[model samples]
Target: MTSRDTDATTDATTDAAAREHATATTAATGPAATAADAPVTISYEEIDGARIAVVSLNRPAKLNGLTMAMLRGLDDAAATLRRDRDLRGVIFAGAGNSFCAGLDFGSVLKKPMDIVKAFAPNPLAGDGANLFQRVCWEWRRLPAPVIAVVHGHCYGGGVQLALGADFRVTAADARWSVLEAKWGLIPDMSGARTLADHVGAEQARWLTMTGRELSGAEAVEVGLATETTESLDDAHSRARETLRELMGRSPDQLAATKSLFNHAWRSPRATFRAERFEQAKLLLSENAARARTAAMKKTPPNFVRRGTWAFGAKKK
Candidate 1:
């Protein structure tokens, strides 16, 4: 991104909060989205000039697989970001030993139809995207930049979720994969858009079909994870450092610039059009063939693991 104007002296804590207030403007413009309209359980940390929200999958028992509560949390966070007057940017990360393990298999096992329905957007019924998707999309809609820091395991839905951010930082040993194929599903959680931005159609097909895992290092190479840190701690530290640098710049300029770059990629019309084009092909099955086969056979999908674990690796 090009350099922007700012007051130079960054009162980050204050400026970011003010931007949140500006985002709040949407709250009044759009129809009221009551508690009933909320998605799920992701939580947040409101910063002065930005938001450092940690939207955890919260089901650590399920390795933080997604849930309706998590989805509601994502929407609520987006609403807050939307209504906020001073927010300038956002940071999307996760909690626990693993970032997120994707959807909860146990939940699916117990209530397959219900669980699947929850992930569906139901455009005809008014909701067009689910919580897992917004965790990624809302960040893109923000006028300011968003950064995702990944650690531990990020698979299936989780892998696709990170694709939404403007930048990402991943732990060197973090497990990465388009894991949905393992469960006889595809990356339908807004990942198609995010993944395509980084990789070509062919590469995207290969990654999703293989259910291939990637190291944090490999994630950066494939564009799923942006940067690989020696340790998770480093990923946070670097992200914070980058934020400080960004805060030092002008807020309006940064926000406007972010908007411009996003649009340069495509307008709302073009975006959905491309979405249809891609989904049309993927829905036909050239992509998920191998993943489905491997899942049913209960075999480990072909994936090349990278990274070495030495004693006490420093956290990024």
Candidate 2:
């Protein structure tokens, strides 16, 4: 984390088939990952001159379906990114054709212990996040903005995971759905909190209850997608363009901007209070000072990297 040159770290399990097709290269050229690391389900690669973390879900055969291992990997990836001070943006995408098909119900049902372990009550409840919720919430909690690149099938937990991102870009023909209704469940993985942010409460209710599917263009109309394109390549191009634009600005400012809108709906007074407090901190930051100096000189700013700041931390 001290240096952006480090390659994508592997903490997830990968199956043979997935590994054969998936290629992850880091600047450091990490050692060959063990099979213990199977379905090679999650990975992080730096893009756009090491300013963006491209988090990939590598289970292409299963449409990158969620398993207990994949969920844990995502949590680890988030933790790693949380500590990275230099990261300006994040891109979450899936390997193969679909983003993610949803949870692997058959695999999950076979392993009841994994379910129990996932739901086990925490004694301290740090940040009130469990394994399942953390997979989605961690992206929202990051200081940098997260953009999800969606294509093919994005369903159930997949939808929730994308919802956790700051922005979503999808292929025009991609299929999206809140598929939990068919499985006799609700979206317990932070979907309820995030879905409302993108769409109205009524739309969220109908999607969750009926488990209907929507096309990428339809998602944009309904606010589920920030934008849609004719092809997946075009969606990725847009994400890279956004990252390039954001990387030029102060990282702290970007984080503060995300904070403002994320909290706007929950509490108006608190949101206003947060604005003043965040601005005060930003005004005092070394990066902000550099930004101001550069602005006066009519030059591109060379702002300093920001340290990690947790969500809801009280500012001095």
Cα RMSD of predicted structure 2: 8.0
- Number of the top candidate by lDDT? 2
lDDT of 1 by residue, 1-316 (tens): 0011111221112112112322321221113443222223223444433444343333433455665555556666667765553555566665456666676554444666655666667576333776556666777766556777787778877777677777888889889888766656678777777777777677798887888988988888877766888986678767666775665444434544554455546778876665565444333332133334557897643211111122222322
TM-score per prediction, in order, is 0.64, 0.83
Q: Model 1: runs farther than 4 Å from truth?
A: 1-55, 108-132, 264-316
TM-score: model 2 vs. ground truth: 0.83
- Model 2 misplaced stretches (Cα beyond 4 Å): 1-24, 27-50, 121-123, 308-316
Candidate 1 Cα RMSD (Å)? 19.4
RMSD of each: 19.4, 8.0
Residue-level lDDT of model 2, residues 247-283, one tens digit each, is: 7788888887877776767577888898898888787
